[model samples]
Target: MQIDIRAKGFELSPALREHAERRLGFALSWAVYDVRKVAVRLYDINGPRGGEDKCCRIQIALPGTSDVVIEDTEADLYIAINRAVDRAERSLARRLERQREHRHARQPVVEITDDDSAEEFEQRADAGVFH
Candidate 1:
């Protein structure tokens, strides 16, 4: 998967960049096959005046599904990045699970037997037992 990291309102240091990359790589490894790209944006919301203004936004692009976007804010940028990655992981898992369930719920195929007639097939099709 491709990862793009961006920093806003501050210069991004090598240590911080490496930390974010490592954390995200580990966190998203489970859904690596499903993920196409990841975009991470780190923001210093309050600039020099620090509060709970560190924001991390993570956007995951998944195949055949809508992108999952997660945002978290904390006093520490590392904590915000961690929380956002965790949330993104959970969101991607849930979406994949739902898609799997939907796919498995499709109508089953029907095999014609000598004893079965056209009327039987029609009835079964109407009742959604056959597709």
Candidate 2:
């Protein structure tokens, strides 16, 4: 997946960029095929004031599904990123599950075969052939 990391209101350090990249790479590895791109934005809400205003926002792009967004705020940017990534993982799982369920529901539950008799085919069609 493509990852775009940006910092707002503060200069992004190499260490911070590496940390975010590594964290997301490991966390979302299971979704490698499903996830297309990820954009992470870190914000220093208070800037110099510095109170628990660090924010991490992550937006994920998936094929055949709506994008997923997750955000977290904490005293430290690292913590915010960690929390946001965790939430994004859960949200992505849920969205993928819903997508699978929708696709499954739309498919026909029974298939016709040439070996089947007319009566059997009708019965199978009337009441789906469930395993």
Q: Which numbered prediction scores highest in TM-score against the true structure?
A: 2
| Residue lDDT tens for model 2, 1-131 | 99999999999999999999999999899999999999999999988997999999999999976799999999989999989999999999999989999999998766567788889888877777733
The superposed Cα distance between candidate 1 and the true structure at residue 72, in angstroms, equals 0.2
Top model by lDDT, which number?
A: 2
CA lDDT scores, all candidates in order: 0.90, 0.92
**How does candidate 2 fare on TM-score?**
0.84
Off by over 4 Å in 1: 107-131
**Residue 71 shift from truth in candidate 1, angstroms:** 0.2
Global local distance difference test of model 1 = 0.90
lDDT of 2: 0.92
In the order shown, the candidates' Cα RMSDs to the true structure are: 4.3, 4.1
Give the runs in model 2 whose Cα sits over 4 Å from its true position.
112-114, 117-131
- What TM-score does each of the candidates earn? 0.81, 0.84
20-108 per-residue lDDT for model 1 (tens digits): 99998998898888889999999999999989999999999888878999999999999999889889888888999998999888847
